[model samples]
Target chain A: MQQLNEQANIALKRTVIVAIFAAVAVVLSLVESLIPLNMGVPGAKLGLANIMVLTCLYFLRARDALMMVLLKTLLTAFIFGTFSSFLFSIMGALFSFVAMWFLLWVGRDKLSFIGISIVGGIAHNIGQLTAACIYFNTSKIFYYLPMLLIMGVLTGIAVGIAVRYLVPSLSKLSLFENFLG
Target chain B: MKRGDILLIGLVVVIALAFIIPRWFDRDSSEKNHNELRTAKITVDGKLFKEVELTQEEQTVEVENEHGLNILKIHDYGIEMIDADCPDKVCLSFGFVDRTGGTIICLPHKLMVEIQGPAEEDGIDATVK
Candidate 1:
């Protein structure tokens, strides 16, 4: 009976942490959009929300991270963007999540947060651009690939650095330490 | 740096080079014939919608698609997306394209406005190249 209660408590703690991270992800996405960090490329934003996503990935399970991604994308699109924007964000978020998860699993010892984030960023751009190309029915849109790739690297590095700093602090908290473990 | 970091750097460098090389060659060839007449081709859903001489009088071309509306303003030597109903307004933000191989695209509307030089013997448009 005691073991069952302890297990339930752990599950509840995990659920609360996931909810908190999802809310933080949504707020970060909203704030990033407001900044208008246009690098001369269409649909290019700073991707500040990625920092929160990476933190969730590092401190939580893959399913939890994915849940955060889905929640953030849907909420941000409904509140601040249109249907088309929703499509792009969903594609980008899913791609980034998959790439980051794969890299973290396979290269946990060989790669740092920065490297994984960079790959995630590049994958996000590829996913968004692919959707754009399909919608436009033209391959000429690939002309923008180079610009987007460059910006992805820059922003990915920024997000990675943020995660590196934040993860350590969050891990220090007893609630997160227990839940994450 | 770890082995993975080195590999990632190499991958980025190779991708960058791939994109830059073609653009470099294109610039060299286009610069040689700077006086070639330019034409603006507007395509919607991969079909040619209209062709306008860039050197002709200013005009506004309105395009309506299942997705949204886009208004293109053409000048004597350049073209710009003056207005668009797309949420991102990426086409409008592309500003003016006066060069021989410039383009403005509205992904939501599947609209493409590309500036091309005179038809080459190869029959390939500058943008496709």
Candidate 2:
């Protein structure tokens, strides 16, 4: 009975942490949207939510991270985006999650978090472009690829640096340690 | 940053440059062919909204639909999204697209403006001839 109770407590703590990460992601996206970082490239933004996603990926289980991504994507799409925006967000979020998860699994400690984040960022752009291409039914939309790639690399570096600092500090917290254990 | 991170960045930069350098050359070569006319085609929801020939006169086109409204300014040199009513206003940032393959897109409004050169490039040379 005591073991079951302890397991339930850990499960509850995990849910709370995931929820918190999702909330942070949504808020970051909201704040990011408010900032006019248009950069003359359509669909380009700072990708601030990536910081939260990367931090969650590092500190939590993959399942928890996936949950957080879904929460962030759905909530943000409903709150601050339209139907098309929802499509883009879901495609980008899923692609980024899969890429990051695969990198973590395959590379383990072999690859830096920054490298993985960069891949995630690029993958997110590709996914969004794919969604655009399908919706528009035109390959010409790919004309934006070169610019988007550069933007992805720049934002990826920023997100990676943020996660690098965030993960260490977050790991030291008792709540996270307890949940991990 | 790790060595791997540096390598990854280098690879992405190389790929981006590869895509961009060709387009730069294409734009330069196309500019030399002054006889070839360029046309800007704006589409909404994958349907033709309007098509304007690139000429000396500058004009402003206001596109109003149920989705949103976007104002496009067309000049002899290029087409630009001057204003938009969408939530993101990303279209306005597209600035100007002058080159043959250039484009400015407003995803929320399902609007896209594409610049097309004379049909010679697309194997439609018979029609041009």
* lDDT per model vs. reference: 0.80, 0.85
Give candidate 1 misplaced runs (Cα > 4 Å): A179-181, B1-3, B34-38, B44-49, B56-58, B64-69, B76-78, B98-102, B108-110, B115-117, B120-129
Highest TM-score model number? 2
lDDT over C-alpha atoms for residue B81 of model 2 = 89
Q: What C-alpha lDDT does candidate 1 achieve relative to the native structure? A: 0.80
Docking quality category of candidate 1 according to DockQ thresholds: acceptable
TM-score of chain B of each: 0.67, 0.87
User: In model 1 chain B, which range of ten residues has the least summed lDDT?
Assistant: B120-129
Q: Where in model 2 is the C-alpha error above 4 Å?
A: A179-181, B124-129
Q: What digit string (tens of lDDT, one per residue) describes model 1 on residues A42-77?
A: 666778888888888887789988988898888888
lDDT at residue B99 of model 2 (Cα atoms): 83
Q: What does DockQ give for each predicted structure? A: 0.45, 0.67
Best by lDDT: 2
Pick the DockQ winner: 2
Which residue pairs clash in candidate 1?
A: none
